[model samples]
Target chain A: MFHTTFYIRRLHSICGLAVLGMVLFEHIFTNSMAIFGPAALNGALEMMELIPKPIFLGLELGGIAIPLLFHAIYGVYIALQANNNASNYGYCRNRNFTLQRWTAWYLVIFLIWHVGYLRLYTKGITGTPISYELLQNYFQNPVVVVLYVLGMFAAIFHFCNGITTFCMTWGITKGPRSQNVVSVLSMGLCAILCLITLTFMGSYLI
Target chain B: MAEKKVRFVIERQDSPESQPYTQEFDVDYRPGLNVVAALMEIQKNPVTVDGKKVAPVVWECNCLEKVCGACMMVINGRARQACCALVDEIEQPIHLAPARTFPVIRDLLIDRTRMFEALKKIQGWVELDGSWDVKDAPIQNPYTAQTAYEISHCMTCGCCLEACPNVGPQSDFIGPAPTVQAYLFNLHPLGKFDKPKRLNALMEKGGITSCGNSQNCVEVCPKFIKLTTYLAQLNRDVNIQALKNIFNN
Candidate 1:
């Protein structure tokens, strides 16, 4: 039971870092195109849509879906088993420890809504490719805009914090000094990503 | 001038199954007095601040110095050795409690048997036989030996476990001390022969994967062991071992 668990845990980290992490960067960059207005955003989406349907399907399934489902499901199991004593311990890292798990829980809900509503349901019912207009229509709901803002923050925090842990998990940053440096860097990246994504969201409201 | 006094608030429990309660005491403030010395003053009197006689505060200590790792407790919300927690350094009205990660045997005495069991689980020693005269052991590289020596300083003090969020009544993590011990022994040339066994042990549930890398263990360790570094190295080792296991079978 545990032998496979060890591998699964490592794989979970790898999925978060190598797989989902890359997808998040791509996602944020693509969304950031909205800052240039609908035309630029749609043009970027059109470019992506040009990929062969089979290849796109394969990438979505193998690169995103399978790893993501495994990461999410196993992540929930790991989070549940955690004994978060940050309330008692109250160290900076301990607080981050608690936040990481909490963000994970939030992301599970947010992802289901974000993907199910935006990706599958919207496209399935409308019989149209996802476009800036479609996203605009979706975000017109005040509740969705609020939910997306919170969801974006959770995803960004989880991914950036996941990077620091991935480094430690792989022994990339072994010492306290190095780990601190990586942590500061990851936070910087998170701040930058958040700024960019928020700007993108703001474009829709205008 | 009036004599100075240091106050103490100790969490007390009568037995393993009993509820815990706090009792207050005042000890004569002596310069250079550590927490253990203050506790000793309380032990001698066995009286509460309410002016009622009570049972003596129970605790464990072998070496009065920090090396024995006995007498570890939560001092002012931090897990550390009471023998080294000087009264002058800490704020007055010191709060003392057993290291809650382990079962409290009494007032501040905790049963560290789980740590011992973890050490055993990791097989934290080299195998030896007395049937024949042993040959010369391999001389270790000085740098490697230094690293090993640093990790070897862990006294099985429950501080790491106490500070670890992953180690508790509800969690299964074996805590950081034993993980470092496994790495320490694996660093030995002879111990390397049994490296697969140690790696297998760490591969089990509540092994290395259970480490959330919150790093409170490194912060609280009195020995200042580079616990995170060793754990990271062990993480790499186990991954490599897992790959080897996959291909070998």
Candidate 2:
């Protein structure tokens, strides 16, 4: 049988990398209001609206939706398979494996509910069909803003952890050379993601 | 100050089919006493805590450091070297038993031959035809040297096997220690010459595919060796081997 770790970890990496790139683009375009002007941001938003709703939703569901579900499900299978539980290596030991799996699940559930309420339902956050104006109207709620902020950070942490683990899983990182690199990158990714997230959330808190 | 008494509850087994029982003893405490040292004290004077004469406790030790992994046993429910487990650090009435992952040979001794057998199955070595001259070997990078050095630190202590859920009496899984060793040698630039053979061995029954990825082996390894990481790599390596076999056929 094909080893699931190879396929599942690679799947997570491909999906996560694509979503991260897309989210980064969206963030830059939406927040261009302060950089250029309200008119510039509106122009960018109008261009985004030209894309068909079904196509956009399909991309969101396929890219952000399906891969995550498979990643989390297979991630759990791998965790349960490896657990002997005879000895305790402190809570931190092997916890990242399980934590990453559960966090992926949390992200999926959070994303589905938030997306449906924010953009899909008629009486949802936008309170109208998903037009550029509706999208703008939805971001006005502080709760939605906070949830999205946290969700984004959660995604960042989840992706970073997945990427680092993926390297090890694929044997890209091995022995002491790659071992040291994995350690540095694992911590580095977490720190950078945390910083970027704090920067984004800090604006709202202030 | 007068010496204080310490209690020990050690489990004894005559053979694989024999029943096990606990025997308690009291030893005179010293400033730098360890479990092995205390066992030595018991060996010198074989007597129970209840003032009855008995056979001396039997155990194994060497190197007195953790390097050899020969003195490995269950101390207070933790698998580690008895030579380094300080008496003071352990809770009172320190319990000692042979590691359950392997067949017990006696009181605190286990047959680690199974690990060696598994190593043999994986052919955990680099095969050389002796055709290449000794001095004509290719130079390796410093990075490769460093990682090989870490992987070389493995003492085959069977800690990873004990932690692995797939390795048991009922299961035929070869466990993680041997597989990691297989990867270690196979990744050697010279060793890569035998990569196909190694990969084939890993792809066989009780090979790399048997690993469930619970990552318990990584957690319990005292050397902090990356067992799961290597196992995953072996997965990919075996996949390539499978394709090559199909294409060749």
Candidate 3:
């Protein structure tokens, strides 16, 4: 059989949009509850627990872990192998190709720290309370705030640019004009995503 | 006939370590002159347009035809083999330079080892050995045979790579030609035995996914091979193969 990475690439793409994209938006919305005060933020967590443990765990592993692993591993493979010369060549397509890989690398570090701190170490694994106070305390650390902002930027860039790439790779956008439209849309989406993240982060910081 | 003057502005690098500079040469043009013929005329005289003595411009050629893929140079910003680049077909004061995608050996010559290495990675050739006989060849469908033959017409002249935005010193992406070879050989009956091997190679870092699908390759191929078609097909096939591996494992 051919290398599994080929399949992984497509799956990485699909999962990025279908699974991660959906989850990412929901996550920000939940975080956005910070504006309503800590109880509302904590309430969102309580509401999330309404889903049964077995099912939620299954969703976490099947929907999140597997897909994320494939995406990250295959992405690293791409980053290691990518030859970035688009700056010299002045090809927009090549520039996007190289940029996507670089963003993926940024996501590697950011995702690890984000997921590890929030999902694993913070709430789910250790059973710490997911509350507005927790976020307040978390934001007290200047270094943590910097990391979170940087992480948000990286994730948003990867997710947005990822949609653009998905459109091209799947032949959804063939013409240069169509590609330009998609790129513009993704950029717009990036701004929106970052705004939501900042809103959530800002509520805690201020 | 009055001496016909042909001008060449060639990009020259003195040695591997030296910086490059351009020098213009005016040579006596002959009838039916191609880029190579004009280069040859300049070679004997080794004199610049201003009559300054200089080393002869350097380049590589084998078949003196499009087949061998040597003599590939940038003529007017387009990558093509110089042997068949008729002087009359293009505009005057033709600018000649080494293919930008590869390291230049000297003036108008580049090391095409990248393409060869890519071929090796993809196992671009049939593995039939001394142990196999001609009678053991597999029967091929006529339509499939024809298409495969077309893909086989790639001269590896680096024109496609030169035109390709994804291929360069910074990229491990193998470009389009070798990927087509993988798809071509995999269609063969005997070659099916080695399909897994070829596909596995393509699944590597510089393999198929690296292609940005810019579609520039088809336009620049000397043979007009249907590279994107094979790439799309293989993209599907490689996915199926991955599913197969996962299920079996």
Q: Which numbered prediction scores highest in TM-score against the true structure?
A: 1
Q: Residue-wise lDDT of candidate 1 within B84-180, one digit each (tens)?
A: 9999899879999999889999999999999999999999998866676788887876779999999888899889999888898877989999988
User: Over the full model, what C-alpha lDDT does candidate 3 score relative to the true structure?
Assistant: 0.79
lDDT of each: 0.90, 0.70, 0.79
How would you class the docking of model 2? incorrect
lDDT for A196 (candidate 3) = 81
Cα deviation at B176, candidate 1, in Å, is 0.6
lDDT of 3 by residue, B167-246 (tens): 77667788888888898888776677788788778777778878765556766788888776677667666666666667
Q: Rank order by DockQ, top first? A: 1, 3, 2
lDDT of 2 at A173: 61
Kindly report which residue stretches of model 3 are placed more than 4 angstroms away from their true locations once superposed: A1-15, A23-206, B1-7, B27-34, B76-78, B84-93, B127-138
Assess the local accuracy of residue B233 in candidate 3 as a C-alpha lDDT between 0 and 100: 68
Q: Considering only N, C-alpha and C atoms within 3 Å, which residue pairs clash in candidate 2?
A: A82-B214, A176-B147
What is the full ranking by TM-score, best candidate first? Answer: 1, 3, 2
lDDT tens per residue, model 3, A1-206? 34455556677679888888877778778988887878889899889889999999899899888888877886676566545555434555556666677777777888888788888997777889667777788889989898888777777777888787777666466455676798899999899889888888888866
lDDT of 1 by residue, A70-181 (tens): 9999999888877787876788888888999999999999999887877778765666888999899988999998888888888899999888899898778877888899
How well is each residue in B1-249 modelled by candidate 2, as lDDT tens digits?
677999999998877779988899999988889999999999999899888888888788887878888888888877777888899888989999888779988888888999899888877876655876565556665776776777788888887787666676656678898987887887687787888877777766667766644567776677777676677678667767767876877
